[model samples]
Target: MAKQVAKTNAVRLIEQQKIPYELLSYQVEEGQPVDGISASEKIGYSYEYVYKTLVTTVGKSQYYVFVVPVAKELDLKKAAKVVGQKKIEMIAVKELLGVTGYVRGGCSPIGMKKLFPTYIDESAETLDFMIFSAGKVGMSLKLAPHDLVKACKGNFADIVS
Candidate 1:
């Protein structure tokens, strides 16, 4: 059974893997200011290089993880095909927090509630490194895409829409 992890899953993930990682913390405002585009700017990084964690459902399945770029949305059809499913839809924002044990904007791919199938957009590999949430709001982790795949046990493909 999957463990009901604490609030610091991401950090624990790094420790578990014995891999070095740097947590990038930023001040998040009270309200929704900007989406991925502005988040990249706020963090002084490129939009494409920063990845977002999405919880998507295939048919009646609860959810699986999808890591996509901030500049592009998940192409549901492509994502489904890649994951060997007929259809997939993004889960509601509220549901994301529940399943991943992190808020919508702060869902980290590593140390999730369960080891659901994970897909990383192919574009993310083009860069040397990418940034993702640290299992907490306002914290991000910087690491190599290849290392991330090994660390998170994730697969890479062209699943972006």
Candidate 2:
């Protein structure tokens, strides 16, 4: 089931953009996984090049998506300001699942239930490319930052602390 979901998202993105990407698979043990951190090491990619997907709520009326390197933490104040909101808080795992239609470790910027507004940490811009979960744990996709921004309609923000 997990494989099917990831495949669907990958296919959708491919058909949508017709862009080139590499699918990376790694051994991922379930049950309390370390998520993005574990994935970075397992896939032999530097943590700096791997972005973690985070869900957050703003002003009690808006939900936003955040993509940041695991090496940094989400700075809510900075993120809120970037989005023109005064307050922001992390979304619960259940709400995140409902919003993204993907489990905690697998939630991705693409293939979400709704096309929530997205922001990628400014640090990502420094990289030639970045990697993120391909809608499942144990799988990831490698692509250019500009392509990500295009595919996600992502806005750049200094949302990492």
Candidate 3:
């Protein structure tokens, strides 16, 4: 019998929308770092197809989500401009769970505590499909970029460095 994959909020949301996606799960050591690049390698996917989700805040409140390629960095200035914010900084790692209901390496643009404005890197717009964390570490969701954006109500922007 094949091992079963538990449904995460991200996966559940995708299914609820009737969006097609592939769920990928990989082994993770107790202390092994499970970053985006590591996840891509384990999943047999290229860096281009894997993305990382980041959460940024304008001040004490007002959070936003940004999804970018695994190999690129989120250019804060460009990100702020795209979101109509004068300045924004990544939400502290310690605050991630409280703010987005996801811990580091497990954050997904979908199924957050609240639906914040979301943006996907323009680089993803051309890809047939993109993958990101499935609301859990060592798990990812693969789907068409356009479908992802529609599911999350996100826009594409040049927000990477």
Which candidate has the highest lDDT of all? 3
Query: Where is model 3 more than 4 Å wrong at Cα?
Result: none
Q: In model 1, where is the ten-residue run with the lowest total lDDT?
A: 2-11
Give a tens-digit lDDT track for model 3, residues 18-113. Answer: 999999988999987788888899999998899999999988889999999989999999999998989999999999999989989999999999
TM-scores, each model vs. reference: 0.89, 0.90, 0.98
User: How far off is residue 50 in model 2, in Å?
Assistant: 0.6
In model 2, the runs with Cα more than 4 Å from the true position are 1-6, 59-61
- Deviation in Å, model 3, residue 15 alpha carbon: 0.3
Query: lDDT per prediction?
Result: 0.81, 0.82, 0.94
lDDT of 2 by residue, 1-161 (tens): 46543484744775589877788878765576766777898999888899999999965557899999987899999988888888899998877776678888877898888888999988888788899978887778888887888888888888987
Which candidate tops TM-score? Answer: 3
Instruction: Say which prediction, candidate 2 or candidate 3, comes out ahead on lDDT.
Output: 3
Candidate 1 residue-wise lDDT at 141? 86
- Compute the lDDT of residue 156 as modeled in candidate 2: 84
Q: What is candidate 3's local distance difference test score?
A: 0.94
